[model samples]
Target: MSQMITIELNGQQQPLPPGSTVNDLLAIVGSDGKSVAVLVNDRIIRPESRALHQLQEGNRVELLIFAGGG
Candidate 1:
Protein backbone atom coordinates (compact mmCIF):
# COMPACT_ATOMS: atom_id res chain seq x y z
CA MET A 1 0.00 0.00 0.00
CA SER A 2 1.23 3.47 -0.87
CA GLN A 3 1.65 5.83 2.02
CA MET A 4 -0.22 9.11 1.86
CA ILE A 5 1.84 12.24 2.29
CA THR A 6 0.81 15.79 3.06
CA ILE A 7 1.73 18.62 0.73
CA GLU A 8 0.76 22.25 0.48
CA LEU A 9 -1.40 22.80 -2.55
CA ASN A 10 -2.65 26.29 -3.29
CA GLY A 11 -2.07 27.31 0.28
CA GLN A 12 -4.08 24.38 1.61
CA GLN A 13 -2.65 21.21 3.03
CA GLN A 14 -3.59 18.24 0.91
CA PRO A 15 -3.00 14.55 1.36
CA LEU A 16 -1.76 12.60 -1.59
CA PRO A 17 -0.21 9.24 -2.16
CA PRO A 18 3.51 8.90 -2.36
CA GLY A 19 5.16 9.15 -5.79
CA SER A 20 2.35 11.38 -7.00
CA THR A 21 3.41 13.52 -9.94
CA VAL A 22 2.20 16.99 -10.87
CA ASN A 23 -0.13 15.39 -13.38
CA ASP A 24 -1.59 13.31 -10.61
CA LEU A 25 -2.10 16.36 -8.47
CA LEU A 26 -3.96 18.13 -11.20
CA ALA A 27 -6.23 15.18 -11.67
CA ILE A 28 -7.02 15.13 -7.98
CA VAL A 29 -7.88 18.84 -8.00
CA GLY A 30 -10.02 18.41 -11.10
CA SER A 31 -7.94 20.79 -13.19
CA ASP A 32 -6.04 19.67 -16.27
CA GLY A 33 -3.48 22.49 -16.25
CA LYS A 34 -4.28 23.15 -19.91
CA SER A 35 -5.38 26.72 -19.26
CA VAL A 36 -3.61 26.99 -15.96
CA ALA A 37 -0.09 27.79 -14.90
CA VAL A 38 1.49 26.04 -11.97
CA LEU A 39 4.08 27.31 -9.57
CA VAL A 40 5.65 24.62 -7.46
CA ASN A 41 7.79 25.75 -4.59
CA ASP A 42 8.34 29.12 -6.23
CA ARG A 43 9.39 27.45 -9.48
CA ILE A 44 7.45 27.41 -12.68
CA ILE A 45 6.65 23.95 -14.03
CA ARG A 46 6.28 23.56 -17.74
CA PRO A 47 3.42 21.54 -19.16
CA GLU A 48 5.74 18.93 -20.65
CA SER A 49 7.32 18.35 -17.28
CA ARG A 50 4.08 18.00 -15.30
CA ALA A 51 3.90 14.27 -15.95
CA LEU A 52 7.41 13.79 -14.66
CA HIS A 53 7.40 16.44 -11.95
CA GLN A 54 7.55 14.58 -8.71
CA LEU A 55 5.98 16.45 -5.81
CA GLN A 56 7.87 16.23 -2.57
CA GLU A 57 6.60 16.65 0.96
CA GLY A 58 6.21 20.24 2.17
CA ASN A 59 6.17 21.52 -1.38
CA ARG A 60 4.10 24.66 -1.94
CA VAL A 61 2.06 24.55 -5.10
CA GLU A 62 -0.03 27.29 -6.68
CA LEU A 63 -2.36 26.86 -9.61
CA LEU A 64 -3.09 29.86 -11.80
CA ILE A 65 -6.27 29.28 -13.69
CA PHE A 66 -6.86 31.53 -16.70
CA ALA A 67 -10.35 32.68 -17.33
CA GLY A 68 -11.50 34.36 -20.52
CA GLY A 69 -14.36 36.77 -20.85
CA GLY A 70 -15.31 39.03 -23.69
Candidate 2:
Protein backbone atom coordinates (compact mmCIF):
# COMPACT_ATOMS: atom_id res chain seq x y z
CA MET A 1 0.00 0.00 0.00
CA SER A 2 1.24 3.48 -0.85
CA GLN A 3 1.31 6.24 1.71
CA MET A 4 -0.92 9.29 1.40
CA ILE A 5 0.40 12.83 1.49
CA THR A 6 -1.17 15.92 2.97
CA ILE A 7 -1.27 19.24 1.16
CA GLU A 8 -2.85 22.60 1.73
CA LEU A 9 -5.37 23.00 -1.06
CA ASN A 10 -7.07 26.35 -1.43
CA GLY A 11 -6.49 27.04 2.26
CA GLN A 12 -7.78 23.62 3.33
CA GLN A 13 -6.18 20.34 4.13
CA GLN A 14 -6.34 17.81 1.34
CA PRO A 15 -5.14 14.23 1.39
CA LEU A 16 -3.74 12.75 -1.78
CA PRO A 17 -1.88 9.66 -2.80
CA PRO A 18 1.86 9.73 -3.11
CA GLY A 19 3.27 10.85 -6.47
CA SER A 20 0.12 12.80 -7.19
CA THR A 21 0.59 15.56 -9.74
CA VAL A 22 -1.24 18.81 -10.20
CA ASN A 23 -3.25 17.29 -13.02
CA ASP A 24 -4.17 14.38 -10.83
CA LEU A 25 -5.52 16.64 -8.13
CA LEU A 26 -7.52 18.63 -10.64
CA ALA A 27 -9.06 15.45 -12.00
CA ILE A 28 -9.81 14.15 -8.54
CA VAL A 29 -11.60 17.35 -7.67
CA GLY A 30 -13.50 17.32 -10.99
CA SER A 31 -11.88 20.54 -12.14
CA ASP A 32 -9.91 19.17 -15.05
CA GLY A 33 -12.51 20.24 -17.55
CA LYS A 34 -12.58 23.82 -16.36
CA SER A 35 -10.27 26.71 -16.93
CA VAL A 36 -8.09 26.88 -13.87
CA ALA A 37 -5.01 28.69 -12.73
CA VAL A 38 -2.77 26.62 -10.50
CA LEU A 39 -0.24 27.91 -8.06
CA VAL A 40 2.26 26.03 -5.93
CA ASN A 41 4.35 27.67 -3.28
CA ASP A 42 3.25 31.02 -4.64
CA ARG A 43 4.54 30.24 -8.14
CA ILE A 44 2.25 29.89 -11.08
CA ILE A 45 2.04 26.50 -12.74
CA ARG A 46 1.27 26.65 -16.41
CA PRO A 47 -1.25 24.32 -17.97
CA GLU A 48 1.35 22.40 -19.95
CA SER A 49 3.33 21.79 -16.80
CA ARG A 50 0.49 20.60 -14.60
CA ALA A 51 0.96 16.97 -15.58
CA LEU A 52 4.63 17.12 -14.70
CA HIS A 53 4.40 19.06 -11.48
CA GLN A 54 4.37 16.56 -8.68
CA LEU A 55 2.77 17.64 -5.45
CA GLN A 56 4.67 16.99 -2.25
CA GLU A 57 3.67 16.64 1.38
CA GLY A 58 3.05 19.94 3.13
CA ASN A 59 2.97 21.75 -0.19
CA ARG A 60 0.55 24.64 -0.42
CA VAL A 61 -1.57 24.64 -3.55
CA GLU A 62 -4.02 27.18 -4.82
CA LEU A 63 -6.39 26.68 -7.70
CA LEU A 64 -8.30 29.56 -9.21
CA ILE A 65 -11.03 28.67 -11.66
CA PHE A 66 -12.49 30.95 -14.27
CA ALA A 67 -16.21 31.11 -14.83
CA GLY A 68 -18.19 32.65 -17.69
CA GLY A 69 -20.98 34.81 -16.42
CA GLY A 70 -22.17 38.29 -16.90
Candidate 3:
Protein backbone atom coordinates (compact mmCIF):
# COMPACT_ATOMS: atom_id res chain seq x y z
CA MET A 1 0.00 0.00 0.00
CA SER A 2 1.11 3.56 -0.67
CA GLN A 3 1.72 6.13 2.02
CA MET A 4 -1.17 8.37 3.00
CA ILE A 5 -1.72 11.73 4.62
CA THR A 6 -4.59 13.48 6.32
CA ILE A 7 -5.74 16.84 5.03
CA GLU A 8 -8.58 19.24 5.49
CA LEU A 9 -10.80 19.95 2.51
CA ASN A 10 -13.49 22.58 2.65
CA GLY A 11 -13.46 22.38 6.42
CA GLN A 12 -13.64 18.60 6.45
CA GLN A 13 -10.92 16.15 7.22
CA GLN A 14 -9.99 13.55 4.63
CA PRO A 15 -7.23 11.07 3.98
CA LEU A 16 -5.25 11.22 0.76
CA PRO A 17 -2.73 8.74 -0.47
CA PRO A 18 0.80 9.87 -1.09
CA GLY A 19 1.74 10.70 -4.71
CA SER A 20 -1.85 11.69 -5.37
CA THR A 21 -2.17 14.72 -7.62
CA VAL A 22 -4.58 17.63 -7.44
CA ASN A 23 -6.54 16.17 -10.30
CA ASP A 24 -7.03 13.04 -8.27
CA LEU A 25 -8.62 14.97 -5.43
CA LEU A 26 -10.86 16.86 -7.80
CA ALA A 27 -12.15 13.59 -9.17
CA ILE A 28 -12.53 12.12 -5.72
CA VAL A 29 -14.70 15.06 -4.67
CA GLY A 30 -16.59 15.15 -7.95
CA SER A 31 -15.35 18.60 -8.87
CA ASP A 32 -16.41 19.78 -12.32
CA GLY A 33 -12.93 21.16 -13.05
CA LYS A 34 -14.34 24.62 -13.73
CA SER A 35 -14.83 27.78 -11.70
CA VAL A 36 -12.83 26.27 -8.88
CA ALA A 37 -9.58 27.36 -7.30
CA VAL A 38 -7.26 25.26 -5.21
CA LEU A 39 -5.04 26.44 -2.38
CA VAL A 40 -2.45 24.24 -0.77
CA ASN A 41 -0.77 25.33 2.41
CA ASP A 42 -1.91 28.92 1.96
CA ARG A 43 -0.50 29.08 -1.55
CA ILE A 44 -2.58 29.17 -4.69
CA ILE A 45 -1.76 26.26 -6.96
CA ARG A 46 -1.82 26.84 -10.67
CA PRO A 47 -2.86 24.26 -13.23
CA GLU A 48 0.74 23.36 -13.90
CA SER A 49 1.24 22.61 -10.25
CA ARG A 50 -1.48 20.00 -10.15
CA ALA A 51 0.53 17.20 -11.69
CA LEU A 52 3.73 18.24 -9.97
CA HIS A 53 2.26 18.87 -6.55
CA GLN A 54 2.27 16.19 -3.87
CA LEU A 55 0.14 16.18 -0.77
CA GLN A 56 1.95 16.17 2.54
CA GLU A 57 0.79 15.20 6.00
CA GLY A 58 -0.92 17.94 8.02
CA ASN A 59 -1.36 19.96 4.90
CA ARG A 60 -4.43 22.14 4.62
CA VAL A 61 -6.23 22.37 1.30
CA GLU A 62 -8.96 24.78 0.46
CA LEU A 63 -11.19 24.38 -2.56
CA LEU A 64 -13.04 27.51 -3.53
CA ILE A 65 -15.81 27.62 -6.07
CA PHE A 66 -16.63 30.72 -8.04
CA ALA A 67 -19.98 31.53 -9.53
CA GLY A 68 -20.44 32.85 -13.02
CA GLY A 69 -21.86 36.30 -13.47
CA GLY A 70 -23.52 38.08 -16.33
Candidate with the greatest TM-score versus the true structure: 2
Predicted structure with the largest lDDT when compared to the true one: 2
lDDT of 1 by residue, 1-70 (tens): 9788899988899999999999999999899736779899999999999999999989999999857778
The regions of model 3 sitting more than 4 angstroms off are: 68-70
Q: Residues 1-70, candidate 3, lDDT per residue (tens digit)?
A: 9767888887889898887788788878888467579999889988777877887777789988867778
Q: Local distance difference test, per candidate?
A: 0.90, 0.95, 0.83
Candidate 2, pairs of clashing residues: none
Model 2 segments beyond 4 Å from truth?
Answer: 67-70
Looking at model 1, residue 59 earns an lDDT score of 92
Task: Put down candidate 2 lDDT per residue, 1-70, tens digits, no spaces.
Answer: 8989999999999999999999999999999989999999999999999999999999999999767779
Question: Model 1 clash pairs?
Answer: none
What pairs collide in candidate 3? none
Q: Lowest summed-lDDT stretch of 10 residues in model 1?
A: 29-38
Arrange candidates by TM-score, highest first: which order?
A: 2, 1, 3
Candidate 2 weakest lDDT stretch, 10 residues? 61-70
Among all windows of ten consecutive residues in candidate 3, which has the lowest summed lDDT?
27-36
Candidate 1 accuracy as TM-score: 0.88
